[model samples]
Target chain A: MKTAVSAPPARRPGGPAGRRRPGGGLSGRLGPLGVAAVAVAALLVLAALLAPVLAPYEPDIGSIVQRYLPPGPEHLLGTDQSGRDLLSRLLYGARTSLLGAAAVVVIAGVGGTLLALVATWFGGRVDAFIGRVLDLLFAFPNLLLAIIVVAVFGTGMAQATVALAMAYVPYTARVLRSVALRERRLPYVQAAELQGLSGVTVSGRHLLPNIAPQILTGAAINFGYAMIDLAALSFLGLGVQPPTADWGLMVSQGQDSLLQGYPQQSLLAGTCIVVAVAAFSVIGERLGGRAAGGRA
Target chain B: MNDDVKGTDGGVIGRAGGGSRRTAGAGGSGGSGAKGPGGAGGSGGNVIEISGLCKRFVTGRGSGRRTVDALDDVSLTVADGSCLAVVGESGSGKSTLARILVGLEAADAGEVVLAGRPVARRPRRAERRARARDIQMVFQDPNGSLNRRRTAGSAISEVLAAHHRVTGAEARRRVEELLEQVGLRPAHARSLPGELSGGQRQRVAIARALAAEPRVLVLDEAVAALDVSVQAQVLNLLSEIRRDRRLTYLFITHDLSVVRQVSEEVVVMRQGRIVERGSTTQVLDDPQHPYTRLLRDSAPRPGWRPVRAIGRDAAEVEA
Candidate 1:
C-alpha cells in the first residue's frame, strides 16, 4: 500500500500480441481439415483453369470400340454412353461447380452486406422498406426462384450463377442487417460518434469490421447452400449445358442409364456435390469457432 | 472478492486532523492565491448545476421487485475550472450520477444544466455527441472501457477525425498531439490497448478523453483500480491537466484521502444522497453530519500512536 507519489498509469502486462502467441495456435488443430478442404478447392481451381491439360482424355472424345469398358488401366474409370471419358468429364466438372459457387458467394456476400449495412444504418422507414422487400424475396423457395431466374435468362454458367446469387442475397442481407443494428448501439460506437465521426464513416469503419466475422461465417454457410442450389438447377437441365461438363449436368446425363447398370457417372457427380458442401461446411465450422473464440 | 485493506499508511497521505503543521499552507494552496491567473487560472463558478436528480430502474414485467432508485434527488454543482470530488462507497449512487451527467443514462426526474444550458432529456444525436465531446468521461478499469480491437492512435484520432473532420495526415498529427499531451510517447500510436500496461491503457483512456478537448471532465473512479503508486501519478497528472488546461473536473471516487489531495470542493454521498458538502477542509476537518463524522472516524490515520488509556474514564471513552 505504500503508494508512489508519481506512478504512471501504464503497465504492459504482456509482450506484443497479448492475445495470441506466434505459430499455428488454435489453427494447428484445424490445419489438417483446413488443408484438406483447401487442397480440394485448389485442385478444383487448377482443374478448372487447366481443364485441357488435367483431363486425361478430351471430355467429348469417345470410341464405340472403347465404350462400356469399366475401370481399367487403359480405359481408366471407363467410357460413358456417348463414348465420352468419365474421368475427363469428372475433372472438368470440378472447375464448373467450384467456379459457379465462388461467383455466387462473391456476388451475394458483397451485395447483401452492403444492402444490410445501408438498411440498418438508415433505419426506420429505410429499414422497414428493405426488410419488406427482402421478406418478399424470401417467400419463394430457393430452388424455385433459381429456376425462374434460369428460365428467364436461359441456361448457361452466368445465368445459373445469377439465379443462385439472387436467391441467397436476401438471406445474407437480413442477417447482416440484424448484425449491423446490434453494432450500432455499442459504447465504442457512441464513443466514435462523440468524436465527430459521420454516420457513413461510423457504419463503414466501425460497423463493417465488427460485422466482418459474422458475414464471413455466413458467407461460408451460404456457399454450401449455393452449391446445393446450383447442383439442383443443373440437374434440372437449366444449368451448365451438355458439352461443358458440370457435375449436376453429368448426373442428369447418367440418370437414364441407371437400369443398364452403368452408375459410375451419376455416382461421380453426386460425390462432387457432397464433397464440396462438406468441405465448405467443415471449414465454416472451424472459422465460426475461431471467430467466437476471438470475440471472447 | 477483493480484500479491504485498512492499513493506515497504505497510500493515504497526511492524516485528516492535527498532524500537519504544513497542513495550513497546503489548505491555502488551491484557493484565493491559487486562484491567481498564474497559479491555477481556471476558477469560474458553477459550470454544472444539478437539482433534484433522481433515477429509478424498473426491471421485470408486471409485478416484480420494487423499483430500484439509483439516484435519490441528488443535487450538486461543480465550480467552473475547479475539481469537485464526489466520494461514495459502492452502491452509493455515484456511478449512476456520473452516467446521468454524461447522458449515458436518463434520469427519472431532475435537471442537469451544463454551462447554463439545460440538458435535453433526449438530445438529438448530433447535439448529444457535441455535448459528450464537451463533457468527456474517463472510465475506471481502463482495459474494459476501451474497445480492445482499436489501436491507441486510431482510438484517439477517431475522436478528432470523427467530430472535427480532420483525416489522414492532419488527424495523425492531432493524435500525436493528444498522445504527447497525455504523457505517452509517439511510438504508442500503432500499439493496441492489449499491448499496453494497465497504467499505459489508463493513460490512453485519458488521451482519449482529451481527444475531444473537453471543458468539463467527468472521471468516474478513473484511478480506483490502479496500483497505489500509479494512482498517485495519475492523480498528479489530473491535477496538472486541470491546472494547465483550466478544465473543470467532476471527480468521483471512494477514497477520502484521494478526495483530500486533488479536489478543492468535496461532496460526500451515501446510498444515492449527498450526506455532506463543503470545501474539503471544512467537511473533512469539521464534519457537521453524523454520517460524515462516522466516515471520517473510520478513515485510516497513520503515524499517530494510540496511547494506553490512563484508567476507567479512558476505557469508557474508548468503548
Candidate 2:
C-alpha cells in the first residue's frame, strides 16, 4: 500500500466553525417578530433614559386623592397602590430594570472574556480546571446561585446586580471560550506565531476581534436573563427597596390591589418586563446568528 | 459546510505548530559552516539540510487503526538561495515534510539543520519563536493564511512589529513596500482578505511571509489553488522575490509540470519514501524508478492514453 502521508490535518467536517448560517440578517427570517421586538425594546430604553422628562409626575411621591385612580387623562397608566403615577413609575422602573441588567452583562462579559483568554492560553490542565469550574457554575440554577450571593452580600440593587452577574459569568466564559478556542488554532494565529509574536499579542489582536460579535451576542442574551432574574429578586424584596419605582418592586407592591380589581400597576409593570426581556432575547439571537453566519 | 475549505487550513496549521514535540533520529546536515547572524545575514550556502528524517502519525484516535509513515529516512539538501521541489501524489508526505521544515510538526525521528544551526527536537519557546523569525512559511491557501479581521496592510505591519520591532508609521511604510514587492498596490493594503480575490489574497500572503524577511520559506503547495495564468504569475513573483532577497525555498507540490518553472532539483516521494532525486530535467526526461516512469507516463498530454503493463492482467500467461 502507498505510504499515506497525513492527509491535511485540517479538514474538520463542516469546516472549523461548524456553524449553520442563519438565513439572513436580523430582519430576514425573524421578519416582523424581530423588528417589533427591537422597536419595543428601543422605546423602553428611551423611556427609561428620559424618565424625568417623559413622565407627567414624579415616580416616588404619591397623593392620597390620586391613589387607586383608574387610567385617566390627568394620571396616565393610573395610580399605583401608593397613588404614585403608574406611567412615571414604569418609566423609572425601566431605568432600574435595564440598567441593572446592563451592569450584569458588562460585569459578566469582562470576567468571562478574561477567563476565556486565560483558559485558552494555558490549555491542557489549566483549561480543564477552568472547564470544571464553569461546569460547577452551570450546575447551579442561575437564580438560586444569585439568591445565595444576595443572601451573603445582603439585599440591595448593587449586591443583587453583582450576584446575578457572577451567576452568569460561567455561561459567558463557556460560550466565549469555545469560540476563542476555535480561533486560537486557526492558521492566521499560526501565521502570527511564525512572526514570533507573543501569545497575548496574538490573542488580543486577532482572536479577540474575530470573536467580539459572539461575545456581544452572548452578553445580549445574558442581559435578558439578568433582567428576569433581577425582577424576580426584586419581587421577592431582595433587590430595590420599596418606593424605588422598580418594576419588580411595583409587582410586589401591586399584588394587594390585584385582589381589589385595580390591577393596572402590576399588569403594566408585568407587561413591561415581558416586552423588554423578549426584545433583548430576540436581539441576542439575531446578533449571534449574524456572527455565526460571518464566522462560517 | 459552504465555508469549510475556506477556513480550516489555518486551524490545522495551528494544531500542527503547537503539537507535542517528539525526539527523532539525528538528521542535522552538519558540515562546519559559520552560523552567520541568526536572523538575516548568511553565507548564502545550504539554507536547509534534512537527513534520515522520519515522521509517523497515529490516526483513528484510540481505535488503534494504523500508523501513517509520513516520512521515512528522507534525506535532502536545499542549496542557499536555491529552490528544490518535493513532488509526489497527495499522500506522498511532501506536505508533512514541509510542515516539519517550518516547525509546524514534530518529527518522530530525524535532524533538520537550518542555516548551519541544528534545530533541537524541542527547543525552548523563545528559541522556537526565534527560529520562526529565521524561517517562515507561505501556506497553500492565502485566504486561510491571513487574518480576516485585519486589513492587508495592518497584517504585514504586525509581522514587521513583532519581528523587527518597527512601529507606527515606519511599519506602515514598510508594509506598503512589501505589498508592492508582491505585485499588490498600496491601496490593496487597506482591503481585508474577504474583499480581495483569490489571486490578490495569495499575493497578500506572500507579502506577509516576506515581511519576516527570513532566510528560508517553506511553500506547501503555495500556488496550487490559483488559476493556470495566476499560477504562472505567482511562480514568477516567487522567483523574482528569491532573486531580490536571496531566499531559499522548499517548494512542495504534486504537480510536476510546474516543478521546472520554480525548482532546480526535484525529489519524488512515494509512500513516505524518496524514490527519485536529481535535477528537474534529468528526472523528468530520463526516469529510473518504475514509479517515476509511471508518473512521467501519467502527466496529462493531448492524445495520451493509459498503456498496458507488460505481461500483466489476463496476459500474465504470456510471461
Candidate 3:
C-alpha cells in the first residue's frame, strides 16, 4: 500500500484563533448585564443564608399594635399587615424561596439530563418511548400539575416542589435530548464505541461532557422558572403555608392591605420576586448565547 | 459466496506469516508489485468475509417515507495482511459496508465473519467489545473523530485502557510511543483536537485505531478530508503501520487514485451493488464494465477535460 512519500512538516503551528485560550475568559464572555445578574443572584443567596443573623426581629413574631407601619427608622420597607418587619420577613423568605427553587432545579435538571443521555445513547424504540412519555408530561401546565400534587399530597413546600420538578422534567429533557442526539451522531461517540468502551462509558464521558453547556443553560433557565412557579403556588395558598416566611405567602398576606390604600407589602414582595427571576433569566440567556457561539 | 476464489494465492499467506515489517525501499512497491489478477483472491485464512449483506434506511415519516437500500447483497473477502479498496460514488454502499463490518450498523440481512468468527447482528456488550478488538474504523473527518474536549493523549489512552489493562504511567508511556510511531511529538499529545492541524488530527485518529491492535482496519474515506500533500503522508504512514502489524484493511473510498495507490484488489460499486472486481492493474488499465470505465475516466488527471459523455453514461449506468 505504499505510495510516493510527500511527508509534510509534523506541526503547522496553530492559527491565531486556535492558540487564543479555551474559554476566552469568564469576564470577557459575560457582558455588563450578565455581571449584574450574577451579582444579584449571589447577593440573594448570601441574604438567604444569613437571614437568621441579618433580620432584627423574628419573621413570624409580629405585634398587632405596630401593624401597617410605613417605612421609617423603626421598620425599613414598612411593616406587613401582621406588623412583621418586612425586611426581616423578606430576608427569611429568600431562604425558603431560593432553596425550594434550587431543589426543583436540581431534581428536574439531573433527572432530565440522565433521561436524555439514555435516550440518545440507546436510540430507536427506546428513544421513541422516552420521548412519548416526556411529551405526555409536557402536555400538562406546570401550575396545574403542582395544584394536583398539592391536592393529592396536601399543601407543603416539599410536595409542591416535587410536583413542579416533575412538570419541569419534560422541558429540560426535550431540549437536552435534541442536543444530545446531535452530539451522539458525531464521530467522536462512534470512535469511543469502536474503542471497546461500554455504552455507559461513552454516554457519560463523551456524550455528557459535549452537551454540558446546554445542561447548564437549561438548569439556569429552569431555576428562574422554578422560583416563579413555586412562588405562584405559595401565593395561591398551596405552598410554604401561612406564617412561614415565603415571598409568595407575603404577597397573598399583603393583599388586604393593598385594598386599604397601603400597597407597600404586596408591591415590595412582588418586586423582589421579579428581580430574582429577571436576574436568573439574564444569566441563562448569556450562557445560552455563549453556548451557541461556541458551537458556531 | 465465492468459495471458489478462496486459497488462490499462497504467496500472500507466506508473506503474512513471515510478519516482516516493510523497509522504506520495499514499501514503495510492496503489495501491488509483480502480482497477477489471480493473486488478488483471498488466501485460505481470510481476515474479513462478508456475504449477502443488505441495509435499508427508511427516511422521513408516514407518507413521505422512502426506503433506500444502502447495501444490496454485497459480498467480498479480504486476505490476511492485504488491503481491499472499495471504490464508489457517495451513497453507493461502500461506507455502509464498512459501518456494518465494524458493528456500527446492523445489516438487515447478512453475515460478517472477522478472523473466522461470525459477528452477531444484535451484539451484547461483551460481544461488541470482542468484535472491536478484531476490527476498528478510522472515519473520514479527522476533526470529528476525536472529542474536542479531550486531549489527544486522553483519546489514545482511553482506547488502550478499554482494550488493555494498562493504566496511569504505563498508559501514558504507551500513548507517547503511539504518537511517535505516527510521527507526532510527545507534546502534541497534550493538545486538543481543535489545536491540531487536519493532518495532525488524522494521525492521532490513526494512532488511536492502532491502539486496538486489531486484525482489520476499516478506513472509511479516512484520508479524503486531508490536503493532497497531507493525504500522501497519511497514506504512507498507514502503509507502514499495516506492514508492521500485518493488518488487513477495508479501504472504502471514492478516489480512484487513492485506490490505485494503496490497494492490491479494487471493487467498483454503484448504487449499492458491486459492478466489477479485479486486481487494481487490470481494472484501472482495461475496464470491463461500463460503470468501471466511467469511474476511471471521471477521475481528474493531467489535461483531462470534463465532458458531456459522463452525464449521459451515468444515466445509462443507472438504467
Strongest candidate by lDDT: 3
Q: For all candidates, state DockQ relative to the true structure.
A: 0.15, 0.21, 0.40
Tell me the spans in candidate 1 whose CA falls farther than 4 Å from its real position.
A1-29, A56-77, A111-187, A236-244, B1-44, B51-58, B61-74, B87-93, B103-111, B163-173, B254-258, B268-276, B280-319
Docking class of 2: incorrect
User: Which candidate ranks first by DockQ, i.e. highest?
Assistant: 3
The candidate scoring highest on TM-score is: 3
Candidate 1 chain B, run of 10 with poorest lDDT: B1-10
Q: Please write out the lDDT profile of model 2 over residues B157-227, one tens digit for every residue.
A: 77777678664666667877998899987767767676677788888888888887777888889899999
- Give the distance in Å from residue B44's predicted Cα in candidate 1 to where it truly belongs: 7.0
DockQ of 2: 0.21
Q: In model 3, what are the clashing residue pairs, if there are any?
A: none
Superior candidate under TM-score, 1 versus 2: 2
Model 1: how far is B186 from its true place, Å? 1.5
TM-score of 3: 0.90
lDDT of 1 by residue, B1-319 (tens): 0101111111121122112222111221122221212222222234566888888877776777667777888776665566778886677788889888877667889888775567786566776776765688888877665666667877887667545777366767777787787788876776776677778888888888887777688998889889989899889888888766777788999888899889867777766778777678888888866566656665667964443343443244335
TM-score of chain A of 3: 0.92
Q: Kindly indicate the candidate among 2 and 3 with the higher lDDT.
A: 3
Clashing pairs in 2: A3-B271, A186-B10, A187-B10, B24-B109, B25-B109, B25-B110, B27-B111
lDDT by residue for model 3 (B48-157), tens: 76777889999999999999999888777666667878898899889998988888889999878776688898777788888888789999988789898888888998
Each candidate's interface RMSD (Å, one decimal) is 8.3, 13.5, 7.8
Between prediction 1 and prediction 2, the one with superior lDDT is 2
Q: Can you give the TM-score per candidate against the true fold?
A: 0.72, 0.81, 0.90
